[model samples]
Target: MDTDVIICGAGAAGLTLAVDLARRHIRFLLIDKAAGPFAGSRGKGIQPRSQEVFEDLGVIDAIVASGGEYPVQRHYTEDGTTVDEPVVVRSEPTAAEPYRIPLLVPQFLTERRLRERLTELGHIPRYGRELTGFAQDADGVTAEIAGPGGEQTVRARYLIGADGGSSTVRKALGIGFPGRTLGVRAVVADVLAEGVTADAWHRWGDGTAAQVSLCPLYGTEMFQLQGPLPFDVEVDLSAAGLTALVRERTGRDDLAIHAVSWASAFEMNARLADTYRQGRVFLAGDAAHCHPPTGGQGLNTGVQDAYNLGWKLAGVLGGAPDALLDSYEAERRPIAEDVLGLSTRLLEAARNRDHRRGREVGQLDLGYPDSPLSLASPGHDKGVRPGDRAPDAPVTGAGGLPTRLFTLFRGPHWTLLGHGVDRASAPAPRTGLRVHTIGARGDILDPGSHVRDGYGLASGRWVLVRPDGYVAAVLDTAGLPAAEAFLDSVGVRPPL
Candidate 1:
């Protein structure tokens, strides 16, 4: 095989997966049809769960640096009256949840941060390359790709489609993308403009009528323009067309559009693929699911999808059972289904002029409770359960330095966190797994009782965290045997 995996897009999803594979020392090819990274602030909200995923992928610092909090939204009526509201209800940060509020970073900046992380790991996405078609067999896949240099055929153990909603890989595989297009239509653009306050997201009309909205994008001088388009009207994506629409809607001769950087027609679509996997090829992000932009779920969901698949791919490529790969679609497809419903509801609410966004949009509460991989202990099903996001807590590492559970889970490794357990009672070292004992006399000291409170575990309990930051199993006193069995079932091998 030429490589272990071939990823066919360089958006948030593909870039995330590439960074993950690179960190794992996995051979992979990352390519994008575009000549360079995305240039728009299409999906700007980095939900809390995705923040944790970025932390593990080693790009959270850059993401946090490049993004800011969502600004208050100011809506204007036809009578020149205005009302103000926060974009999203803010949540206070706790020891377990450090990132509570959503961060407003442009999609382009997010992609750049992931790309920077990929480069640091000695990999770069091949630009100007398009996946024209591919054929997969029992062992691997052979892909036909078109690029600036010409056409080339490449072989890989697996193919991943992260190529956006209209995915070529999904189409070629004969997978069904079934969904309805919502009645909402708009023309979105990124523009350098004047006469707009940078502090608030300005809206021209109430939600009951056609609205023109301009949101100040963080880390850039441009604002993202969203103007309603008539259902039957042909969208004019030209700079003049967008400028005219903005002026016409806002009724402001003072507001000037100096430059149009990027523009596209926005149609709210709620779609989900019939299946996330077909033989040797898998779909993730927009390839597997599409959502309305209301809840800011599209980009964050897609980023997490790549996070879920990356580790599974690494495990399978390292000689795990072929069946281990099936869990990807099973675990993520259901998530997409639920997210589709959520974003659809949020879209409806927006149409009704209910602009209140709650903590649900933060995506911190999403998990795989019913997943086949989630094994809950019989009576220990209280605090953090299997398939739940593993919460972080304050801890003291060697030298009495302040640390966090997230710090131990930062790298590309499974974390075995034994709360209230001593160092002598910790589990033996395993390949690709880090064991941390958090107690008074443990390897890492949790004097604050944060771990106990966060995990809800006493002296004889333990938790096994997946590489993707989900709790795989919560164990009781006799946790070792069950944990070993769970690991074996998932094909975790002993160190050589």
Candidate 2:
């Protein structure tokens, strides 16, 4: 095999997965049909969850430094009536890691950042390489690629189709992409304009006839206009057409289209593959599922797919149980399906002509509930319950080490954090579990803090945190014996 994994597509999902695998010392070949990095900003928002993933990958700072800040978003009726108060959605309190709200960096920039990081790790995505076809068996998968030089054969332990919606790999694999094409088509344009506030995402709703959302891009007076066209009106989306729409909608005839970087018509669709894994070839990102861009979730969800699959792929390749790979589809498929359903609902709400309801659903932070991962310790009361993202908390010890629970969580390792347990006095020779002890004077509720408070973790209780920053097991002092047994069941050895 030329590599451990062959990732087809250099978009956000593919690049992120490659970088993550590289970090874990997994060999992979990442290919894309494009000549090089993208030039335009296609999808331009990074949700909180994605920011956390970026931090784990050690690239969040670079993204923040290169990207512009877009913190406020507002919705208004066509007559210029404010439908809702300007919502401050994207705010991160930490300077070292500031990307809580969805950042306004363009998709091209996001890919560039990921690529740069990948390069730093001594891996570069092979551009102008398209997957012609692929076949998988029990041992490995074989792929045919058409590159600038010509056709070539590449073999890998596994293959991932991160290709876009019209995926050739999916077609070659005979997988069905089930979904409905929307009746409405939206025109999107990225340009620079003066006299426009560069902070908020301004949306003007035309009661379902049409809608326009203007978002600012940093470093210049550039903005992105996304809106639906009239059902009955058929106009070519030339520079003149887009300018006319801006003038008629914003009442600003002077809104110059500095440069129509990229213009395309897109439709909202709700689609998902019936299966995420097919033998040794697995599908992810748009190849697995695609949804409307209404909630700004397309890129975020794809990046998350990489995060969920990267570690498992590395584990299996590194000699972990093959069953671990099954969890990739088990876990991420449902998330993508849910995101598809959510985006569909959001698109329908926007299409409903009810401005208030549309705005409400659009801004709602709909997350996955009822996950077994959210289980809490018995009789625990701190908000750091199970299945939820482990919150960062600040803690100060008697010795004033000035540590944080999240800082201790940096890794590819499962961490066991105890609030008051003395590390030196506790059991020695702990293997597979990185244990850290925090004394009093820690603030767990602060947004900047990595540790959450309500897990019934007292002076002697232990909190088991996963590599992805979710609580896997919580152990009261009395339940230590049972907790050790649980750890063994989960394929982890307890402290000796």
Candidate 3:
């Protein structure tokens, strides 16, 4: 095979998967037909769960620096007066959930950060290269890629479609994408406004029907302008056309849209592929599922799909079983199904003028409890369980240095945490897994009972966390063998 994997589309999903594969030393190719990075502010809300994923990938600092909290929405009328309303209810940080709220960085900035990270890891995406078609046999996949010069044939062990909703890889495979197109039509654009303040998200109308909103994007001077499009009107994506539309909708001739950067007219859609995989090709991100942009779930969900699949792909490439690869669809397809329902409901709520977003939009509670990789212990089912997000807690490392559970879990390896167990009783460290004991006289100390109480380890217990930061198994000290068995089931192989 020419490469281990061939990833089509260099958006959030493809870039994220490329960064992961580079760090794992996995042979892969990342390609995109676009001439450069995406230049839109379409998906700006990075939820808490996605923030944690970025932290694990060593890019949280850049993401946070480029974004800020979601600002309060300020309603406007024809008079240019405003009334402030909190669109998202913010939450305080706790021991278990450190990132309680979402960040508001533009999608272009997020892609730039991921690209920089990939460059740091000695890899870059091949731009202006499109995957024309591909054919897969029992052995591998043969893909035809088209570039400016000419078309070239390449072979890879697997092909992944991280492309957008109109995915060439998915369509070529004849995978069924079954869903409904919402009646709503809207225009989303990035523009520079002369009169709008950057502190609040400015909006007009009754908060729903026939309204226009301008949200100041973090770390940039551009504001994202969005409003409904009339069915009879011919759509115009030009700067002058968008400016006139904004001026007409807000009824504010004083507010001038001086420049427009990127614009698109999109009809809301809620779609999920019938299957995520067929033979050696797999679909992820918008290819596998496309959600309405109501709950800010589209880009974040794609990032997570890449995170969940990256480790498994690396493990399988390192001589693990094919079952590990099979678990990708088994675990992620259901998530897409559920998320489709969620985003659709949120879209309905928006149409009803219920703009208040709550904790459910963060997507922190999403997990694969029914996954074949999850192993449950019937006796210990109080706090964290198999297929639950492993909570974070403050702990002390050697020489009384402050640390966090997230810090330990940030890497390309499985984490086996032993709570209330001594160092001697901790599970032996394996080649692809790291073992750490937290308690009195253990390798790490949980000074304030934070880990003990937060993790529900009233007595001694072992929690095996996957590379993706979800609990794989929860067992007693004697259940180390079972934990190992669960790892075997997922084909956890030694690192290169």
Write one digit per residue (lDDT tens) for candidate 3, span 1-496.
3998999999999999998888889999999999988999999999999999999888989999998998998887667677887778888989889998988999999999999999999989999999988999987899999998899899999999999999998899889999998988899999988778999988787545668889999999999998888766788777778778777777767788878899898888899999988988888899989998988999999999999889988887776787788888998888888888888898888777667789998888999888888886767858877888999999899678999999999899899888777668765556778888776667788888888877788567888899999988888888877887667666663334
RMSD of each: 1.5, 4.3, 1.7
TM-score of each: 0.97, 0.84, 0.96
Error of 2 at 242 (Å): 2.1
Model 2 per-residue lDDT tens digits across residues 1-496: 3889999999999998998898878889999998887766777867767877788888888887777656455776556566544333334455323335556688877888899999999999999998888888889998899998889999899999998888777888889888887677787777765556766767765444556777787644577878887555676566677777877776666665556776767776788988888888888888888878766778888888888788778767755567767767777777787777777776776676432222222222333234443334776666555555565556554554665556667666667776666565443444556766655433222233343343445566677776666676566666666656555544455443
- Tens-digit per-residue lDDT, 108-200, candidate 1: 999999999999999999999999888888999999889998999999999999999989999998999999999888778889888898999
Q: What is the lDDT of candidate 1?
A: 0.87
Compared with the true structure, the alpha-carbon lDDT of candidate 3 equals 0.87
lDDT of each: 0.87, 0.70, 0.87
